[model samples]
Target: MFNSIGIPGLIIILVIILILFGPSKLPKLGRSIGESMKNFKDSTKDIMDDDEINQDEKATKENK
Candidate 1:
């Protein structure tokens, strides 16, 4: 979907964002976005690990 938005499009979008949010808030915005992404990744990883553990337990029970 985002394949069409190449370098020029990205630059334009960045410029628009900079204009709207200004330079001063950019760092805070980036930091918040990074933190949000990290939290999302961690939660997903935990969920996947739990799913794997459940599957393993079920497999062991079936074998028994």
Candidate 2:
């Protein structure tokens, strides 16, 4: 979807965000975005680990 936007479009979007939020709030906004991404990653990792464990248990039961 963003492939067509290219550099100029991305720059324009950033400028609009800056104008709306201002420079002062950008850092906080960036930090919050980063933290939310981290939390999402962690939760996904946990879910994947649980799935792996469940598959391993099923395989073991089938072998028995």
Candidate 3:
């Protein structure tokens, strides 16, 4: 669904953001957003791993 942005559109969006929040808070905002996304990814991976372990245990029990 996400079409790529043209160069002009990208520049305009960046300019608008710079005008609104300025450069100072932008890095901090980006860092927090990146960290939040990373944490979400890690948690999802942990859940998938747990599911795999549970399935393996069930298979082992059924084989006995």
Candidate 4:
């Protein structure tokens, strides 16, 4: 169902949020979202790196 919401739907949603929150709050909201996204990305990267390190260790031990 969510996949059906295309560009037009997103624009409408943004417009509604703008109306509800007012222009003054948008910056704060955007900043909060940006920070959250950054944290999520950083954590994901860390998890991926850990997985790679574990896989490398497993391969090395198996070879030895």
Which has the greatest lDDT? Answer: 2
lDDT for each candidate structure: 0.98, 0.99, 0.93, 0.98
For residues 1-64, write the lDDT of model 4, one tens digit per residue. 8689988999999999999999999999999999999999999999999999999999999999
Q: TM-scores, in order shown?
A: 0.91, 0.90, 0.79, 0.80
lDDT of 3 by residue, 1-64 (tens): 2258878888998899899988999999899999999999999999999999999999999999
lDDT of 2 by residue, 1-64 (tens): 9999999999999999999999999999999999999999999999999999999999999999
Candidate 1 segments exceeding 4 Å error: 1-3
Ranking by lDDT: 2, 1, 4, 3
Ranking by TM-score: 1, 2, 4, 3
- Enumerate residue pairs that collide in model 2: none
Cα error of candidate 1 at position 29, Å:
0.3
Q: Best by TM-score, which number? A: 1
For candidate 4, list the clashing residue pairs, or say none.
none
lDDT of 3: 0.93
**Over 4 Å off in model 2, which ranges?**
none
Which has the better TM-score: candidate 1, or candidate 3?
1
